[model samples]
Target chain A: MAAPPGPESIALLERFVAALKAQGVVTEEEIAEQIARTDRASPEIGARMVARAWTDPAYRELLLRDGSAAAEQMGVSMAGAPPLGVLEDTDTLHHLVVCTLCSCYPRMVLGYPPHWYKSAAYRARAVRDPRGVLAEWGTVLPDGMELRVVDSTADYRWMVLPQRPAGTEGWDETRLASLVTRDALVGVTLPMVAERAAA
Target chain B: MQDDAPPPATHDLGGAPRFRCTPVEPDDAAPPDAFGKRVDALRQLLARKGLMSVDELRRGVEAIPEAEYHALGYYERWLRSISGIMVEKGVVPAEALKP
Candidate 1:
């Protein structure tokens, strides 16, 4: 079993969790479970969404316009919470999403979030310097992509359906799915390889 | 089994037979009781003089978990709470924000 959090952090999180409840963010069990379900890999479900957006133009455009609606096109539903929307990253403006205030994720699509995701460090840093945050995640932005950070709050929520990187023109859906990294889906990480190499 | 659902009246004004939120208050403002519930405790503390609007602050309540927002085991309970608060607070509009 993993070690438990220190008392100071737990106390803070408890108060944090309680505050979120008052704002109508997340609940006790959901918070507990979300904290419990922390993992290294991003949700396989979000990866599938990224893959679908890659080869399908209609789907990609749809995802950019209405994420929740577009997700439904691929069988992922954000119906549990409020009307959630999806946001996409383009060449001129790269989009990165964070609750800033809380961890209001598309829980249905991304599954439970990581512990770091909801951390005050992340919340404060993400808004302050997205490029720095991405760098910490090991993503070095390309020469000319302007990074725009968006705070996903109670009013609006977002998901990043990153553009298919320059490679693997003929790759099938299964092959494409592997290329979609968790970071790419969340907008913090990127698909490093041009295409899925000979793996 | 698909037919198992609470009656529509028990739900929101949408009349779609969804889950219900905890009866905390008039539902116009963020309920004070949510403070002790879950993630909301923090938000309740941080909601300073002009940090945020009632709508934004209310959706911030979503920072909390679902059970405190709506009746447990009621599918779409979370949706009701988030959308309901936003709608009631005029953040998204009644028709557009209806859960």
Candidate 2:
């Protein structure tokens, strides 16, 4: 009898690709072009809600009360998608996001989480040492910051909009929006200061 | 290509060991032609969008000669591991890297 196919054989390649597609990452475009037959994402809607939450105390309270409804109120569609939970980071407890199961996330709000956050190294490490995971992402916690790692399984999606840094007391929404790194918003890393060296 | 890679023995995921599927350097266990294409595919998926670590992957990819680099058998496993590491580092969309 023939040996099972080698890892690089064409048959193996097809199997891997098919397996990956059967998973969700390959489904976004296909979900639109062939399967779902529509284009609907809630990134802008989520972003706006995050911004509003940062601005108004009442709105933030509302968001904490009902994440899905709050997201919808911002004009983001969440039809046929999993539930979303927004995590808020404070001086005491900082949150990091990881998908131990298949990479399930709130794609509607955040668009796409960065690729690195999905590695096996990340999966094992994040659960094993949450603080270490943040360090790799270059997050130097404040003088007294606590770390919390949240698991984003295939069933439920989540997002994070970290607390605005201290210096930008009166910055407008646009400026604040610029501070939200894709990873930070998703809770993998902390919001960073993208300093421009003076000429 | 990492300075600290899991030892040169076959890759052990859980208790099941995945022997060297890609050809290793001549001195290693993989035959001269074992893992050429499998490495290629892993490199392609990792290199897709400046996501995975170039230095590390380049080291692994460059270690094997092109001729023997194309025969790895566990394609799915390679993506799983590659994407796992990528996801670990925040380089893939969670869903994209999910197993």
Candidate 3:
């Protein structure tokens, strides 16, 4: 766990906020609203979209063609965020996302970026040795499969539409979404079907 | 010609060879702590008010010295960037930041 901010740091932040309020630069309600909006965003939003895409062909097409529209279709607000691009992963090809410059994530869909995503090691190796980096996460792709590394930039954010796991043909959207982890959306891992019990 | 190209900024780490040997930590899905959330809220508020843009914040983050960039936490870097931009834009005077 990271250490809490030092007293001096906390004091400075408090003073800064107070000064901003005094100058009518920002109000407490506005700050609280922003926090609430941010808190509402999570990996589940992306997972729901992925699940819908898997079940609805038209929605899938929309998601592939216009990610921002697809996200809004699912009740996610993408008002001020940069355009979102969904990378479709297939059996023959896989996509991995990295913000090589900084952590430019699809926050409106996937919430804030994972801590490791912001690390220098991840930012550096993700583009150079993607397979090796994925290997560290135990996501080993087949030798014949092509691994595509995409850099999510300031102007555009990217998310992965991971291939649906097999043995889930009859699964409902909720059940399918349960299998879609944030790692899968980021293309670091694949969603797997849970084993069933014998009848 | 390759030698004439400017060195990449410290924040520009895409495909950099120096970090090849660095080991990535395991995934931790924990949300930002309270302090981080507050810092993020401040940034969002600033952006909403047209006081700053995401690109300006990124530029401020990129401008940090290499060592300090590595040492600071994620939201701490954001706080620095947001605060710097506020001062740069004359939205909040530098004196207000000092406790």
Candidate 4:
């Protein structure tokens, strides 16, 4: 938006990339493919993991125990990446993730972090007033639910395993996965029964 | 800004009070801006080349002056860190990056 960087600066960056290529540190092909891989890293992977966890108890156990390994088992490659942690949102406890320091995220699984996720307001308020922040994101949990604010402070990135919506008892994985939005996985909102029915 | 509060660090923003309702819209479909992509690619190349470690990049980003830290956007910080680290490490002379 608003033309991020001017042409001169961009030309300088192009020259920088050329220098790197010339040094044999990286190639244009590798950079292109990495960009493509960034695009491929989407919430769909998290959604599929959630859907599988909802349908399979053993998989849910595995997901809760070792998130990175479970993700790999489901064909999501996080090899050599920092450990991924999945927090289970239950009847009494809800998990909300914010990197108050930096915009650390599970980008390997969830594609790009949302703009607000990296905002100063979010980083500051999510820890101070999580309920207020969640309400701003259109999520208002029931009164007295223990809100657990998890910071991505260290090497671990977190994603919330939101509770499965009611009234989707017989739904298949595809149908269930359709209801799992990125925001839901982030614990800012819940998967709506209406969304599941629409699928 | 609390007068009696601890000195502000660049990254310790949790629970610091400045109440403002900043609503965010979903931009999942919008493509990344050109400079953002280039900066990200440059970071990868820099890391791969052993010129900069992810830890070093994080440290550089965290070390950005406090005023600029609040002023810069997400990728802008990465760009600044990449530029700053390249200069600090002498991988590229500062003049080479001058526009």
TM-score of chain B of 3: 0.89
**Candidate of highest DockQ:** 3
Q: In model 2 chain A, where is the ten-residue run with the lowest total lDDT?
A: A30-39
- iRMSD (1 decimal) for each model: 20.4, 14.6, 1.8, 3.1
Better of 2 and 3 by lDDT: 3
Which of the numbered candidates is closest to the native, going by highest TM-score?
Answer: 3
Q: Each prediction's Cα lDDT score?
A: 0.53, 0.53, 0.87, 0.78
Q: Which runs in model 2 stand beyond 4 Å of their true positions?
A: A1-45, A193-199, B1-99
What are the C-alpha RMSDs, in order, of all predicted structures? 17.0, 14.2, 2.2, 2.6
TM-score between model 3 and native: 0.94
Q: By DockQ thresholds, what CAPRI class is model 2?
A: incorrect
lDDT of 2 by residue, A1-199 (tens): 1124453444444454454556433443442342222124424555577777888898898787778888887777676557888888877888877765334567667653333443335555666665655665566777677777787754678888688777767877766666665666767555544441121
Question: Cα lDDT of model 4 overall?
Answer: 0.78
Model 3: residue B72 alpha-carbon error in angstroms: 1.0
Which candidate ranks first by lDDT, i.e. highest?
Answer: 3
Tens digit per residue, CA lDDT, model 4, A13-109: 7766665555566777888777777778898889999999999999999999999998999788886467999999989999988898877788777
The estimated TM-scores of all candidates read 0.55, 0.55, 0.94, 0.90
lDDT by residue (A123-199, candidate 1, tens digit) is 65676666766776667877898887777766566778777777668988877788876556668777755434745
**Which residue runs does candidate 1 get wrong by more than 4 Å?**
A1-42, A194-199, B1-99
Instruction: Categorize the docking of model 3.
Output: medium
